[model samples]
Target: MAQWLAAQPKTIVVQPTTLCPMDCTYCYLLERHLKQEMTPQVASAVADGIGPSWEPVEVVWHGGEPLAVGLTRFVELLQPFESLRQARRVRHKVQTGGGRPITDAWCDVFEQYEIGVGVSIDGPRELNHHRVDRGGRPMFDRTIAGIETLKRRCIPFTVLAVVSQDGTGQAAQVLDFMRDLGTSWVGFNIEAKEGANSDGQTPSIDHARQFWRDTFEWCRRNNDVTVREVSNLLGFLGLTQERRDADSQHDPIPTIAWNGDVVLLSPELLGVRSVTYDDFVAGNVLEDDLSAIVQRSDELLYVQEFTNALETCKQTCEFFSFCQGAHAGDRFFEHGTFAVTETDHCRNSVQAPVLALAELLQAKGSR
Candidate 1:
């Protein structure tokens, strides 16, 4: 079997805790309510696993509401990685729900660390109804208040909006709302079936295509906030096909869960398990070196299958430039394995955006 792409981690998605305050419909974490916070020892062990690598690493303190770990523990969690930060070996980022409180204290720490913040907010109140509290109450106002706090403190942030059926129709409106909310960049994630959040309702490819087209048109008119999808495709369009293919190398994006368990490739695959592949833990940080896990990532049974699938995508798919192999989680969740490609996710998020961007750019050039 062909080996997976050369494995060096570009991003380490650290799940500091599984304790999220708000429950979002699109979220896939099975144990979001569990208070399985990462220990300082585990965090240190993770840092130690890297062993003073000079290559810049992005340490993303990812989901299950990283802020819900409480301010003190949250600060304590960063203690181990201080050396990496000081050495400029790693840059820190946090993707928060923004459903919890974002006080001056949070902003203070963010400023001190110079962390890049990305808030999970789906535009305004109407677009944000999917993310609610445990009691099923809408968290739009609360989330907005937290974002407002960040703005007041002069802390810059990016917004990640999940495009639901409603969002697919109102792309311009959603983009406008997020821009008005003062986000530096707006990233739109398509609602997909993954983990425990599958309710069978997902946006159709036709509708999703429309959303991308509208987003591209809106971006042409208003060049204020960068629409991540549009920007990505635009960059890809600028690149020669040879360069694009060469740049499609899939790095092992290791997601270290609260308990030191590592899931590679797809961060959304952390809590998910497959009978064919077993639990997708490449290795545990406490038991194995991070490099060792990454080295063996290409040899993993599922990864070997992914190698085949990605080969197919590279050969057969027209829009492989946009998403590489799309996402393994989407393949496993939607079609039950990563041994094949052409998932609904690829069509909606990858192909649609690429097609829309190409057509729009061509029209602009002609004009």
Candidate 2:
């Protein structure tokens, strides 16, 4: 238990609020409309809970929409980490949908705190039609305007684009759009069937393979922009000669919700409920010590099952070393159990890209 608790994650994700302005079609946030904000007391509790560490800790501010808390309230939320930041390195990050109103005041906070911003957008206007508001109005222009503001303020940000079936064929166009937006780095997230919205079919593995291949070619042509998925796949395959240590399946990444409830692993698991696992809450940080909660988390039935399933994958699956098994939230949502192995998510996200890139590299080598 001591060895298990020692492997703490470097990043901790905090959900400051659960109030999003837009209602995307495939959003997994079940309680997005709850309109709850994390109190400064809870924020301070969470910060103190983390305590001191040798390495720099990153607090990722994520939510239904983190910006929904407004600039003034958001600063109050960050106040708890000030002591830690002064003592040692404590990096701040915020992940937002980027469709909300972006004011100079918000930019001032970003610049002052040096927060790493990650904005969610699905590419061109046509591709982003699914990420609309409650009135079904397209948010492409609004999101772009917010991104443009970030650019004007000289605050560097990364773009997170969800690749749906509609936009899979337009990889080049998507690359061009992000490039024109002056985005230095872009991450691609497949439209996953998780949480409340499980209507859409997972993209076929073949289609995903082709999409990644095409996107890889585009990235090769434009050396200025970095595509995260391609780079990660290449690194995993040893094609880029940048191999790193495989992520530990048991490492605890504490994701604290707005109410101070701590969820290990995926932050998406915060609001989701399961019949067997209940709310998947290890314990409330406000009540229990963070380290104690993380240590006790290993005793959770679902966590035990999740760890067992990962061990099985490591023993059986060929790609185990690369992915270290699929994410716990993905496995639970797609398979309805953490003890299951191999999901549509694994096929498209993990296997397809590696196979596609391997084939491409093999052909080039043969030539």
Candidate 3:
């Protein structure tokens, strides 16, 4: 086998570009960024710096709309990383809002390279009411058109549906929409305040509990297509022996913003404060050593108290083994600090274990 990229980043999330055309009401990055673009040189530096050194690392292009970075830019950014795939296995993933069709060359990269994409479209029209562009128009039709393009071209893709408060009562309908999309896997994220989503309109605890129960039951019925949010738990229970606890407060995995600033371990760190300054400590990968930059930034005394508190949550909570702590940005936005236990995350994440046990007991009683 060829040598792996050296950084040991099992998953590397890069903001390929920070230019997004959508102006959704609940965008998490809205508070944190305007429209900074990631230069090809900076992207090349990031790829060279953190391409995994051992195991196959997954590369995820996250953005205001990664597609906004354009096909030429994407090609330039991906060239170095692609060379690694030429030698060994390097998985590439992109999280996009699906507002634009990828150019033909980009499609070639998707096919020629081992790239998987996750498109953001909440659900059907009613469920997607909040996913609109700046003109305050519904984007479901255009988003669906983009999805169809991927399907027609046989591009591997997944859907990430944000479950809105209004859509909580219709989990089945929303799920059905995803199934119709013809993807093998899908993710359902509860709308939380982050990025531009500052209205504090996450689902009520009661509703979230019911939604997860129903969603889980739906999965039990299907037995096929995978669900990202829940399967992370099932993977822990039935497969991996690694520490599966969400509350476990280990150092966060690394995430790279458009400017090449590295946010260790927390995906939420990208835009939780100033659009440019929040969660940022810099090393221009194009000019500096990525590892040295990480080492120095890791030493900064920003969230020590919060990290200690998270350790307590992991060690003490009943569902610690199953719950991953909310990203620091999520905790900060929802609870104001990384160390503070996120009551809502606790409630939502705790429901599955409680419900699973109840179902087991009911089955035993019936037997």
Candidate 4:
């Protein structure tokens, strides 16, 4: 169990830069405006840390904006992991805002590397008021234009929409909107109070639960599309006692920042610092060894605090068997400490969705 707990993540999130073209209202990044980019040296060091002995990993290209990093520079960062890709030891995905024009050049690169793409858009144009530019102007059309380009080039993409207060009861509207947009894959992320996003509203618990229920129904009725959250919810509901124990163990999701600094558990911990935990940095790929840092993750102060909080969760949170102290960043960003449990994320992403699925199941059984 100790050995399994100490293993690295199957998915590693790598930030290429801190420059985003659009500033979504609920973005958690503190350094999203800076132009600092990851050096090729840092990329090489990260690749070395993964090594050939490790299992295959999904390398997620994330940033203030991944596509905003420019094609040449983004390719340079990915170059280090080329061998892994060739060996079928690595897969890639990039989460982009699609605020800037996504041209054939980007599509060519996506095809060349087989990078899975995810675009962030909040429902229809009217609901997209929350996604704005540097000048605080809504650019919903601009994002749609990029999606259009992807479609023209026959590049498939997954849409990630934030389910904030404005989107509470409008799940069917959002799903219908996405259906017209021609997306076959969609994901909903509940906006929460975290990082630089202090004002993110938690939808009334009932609204949130209903949102999930409706979303699940939509996907079930419409055979062409699937929702990521629903998939996870279904998977969790099917877990056996032994399976839950094994899957409950936290994977060391190592997120490497532009300069190679590593943060364990959550990407939201990138720029946050606490007086108690100081910076939640586990180590730096440039200075410290990534594999060693992850292996000894328990030594970090915030991790120790999280361990204690998770123990508390077993006693307090009824969803502990499924959640297992799932979101470390949510706990810290919401309460300003990891020695706590039951965050806004816990309710919106975990409990509410779980209950919603159960309710749907009950109704189906009655039928």
Cα lDDT listed for each candidate: 0.84, 0.82, 0.68, 0.85
Poorest 10 consecutive residues of model 2 by lDDT? 240-249
Score every model by TM-score. Answer: 0.95, 0.94, 0.86, 0.94
Candidate 2 lDDT for residue 347 = 82
Per-residue lDDT of 228 in model 3: 82
Evaluated at residue 83, the lDDT of candidate 1 is: 83
Q: What CA RMSD would you report for each candidate?
A: 1.8, 2.2, 4.4, 1.9
Quote the lDDT for 20 in model 4.
88
lDDT of 3 by residue, 185-260 (tens): 8877777776556675788766776777677777877855687866876666784555452223344356777877
Best by lDDT: 4
Q: What would the per-residue lDDT of candidate 1 be over residues 1-367, giving only the tens digit for each residue?
A: 3244655777889999988888887788988878888888888888887745527889999868999888898888898888888888888999999757999999999989878898988876887778999999999888888999999998999988888887798998888887898886988889888887777467998899889989989988898899888888788779887887673567678899999999987888887776888899899999998888887787688788788898898788777656778787888888888888988788888988877767777988999
Looking at model 1, the pairs that clash are none
Clashing pairs in 2: none
Give the lDDT of residue 268 in candidate 2: 80
Q: What's the lDDT of the predicted structure labeled candidate 2?
A: 0.82
Candidate 4's residue-wise lDDT over 48-148, tens digit each?
88955677988988888988788898899889889989899999999988756789999999999999999999898888888999899998888899999
TM-score of 3: 0.86
Cα misplacement distance, residue 322 of candidate 2 (Å): 1.1
Model 2, runs deviating above 4 Å: 1-6, 237-251
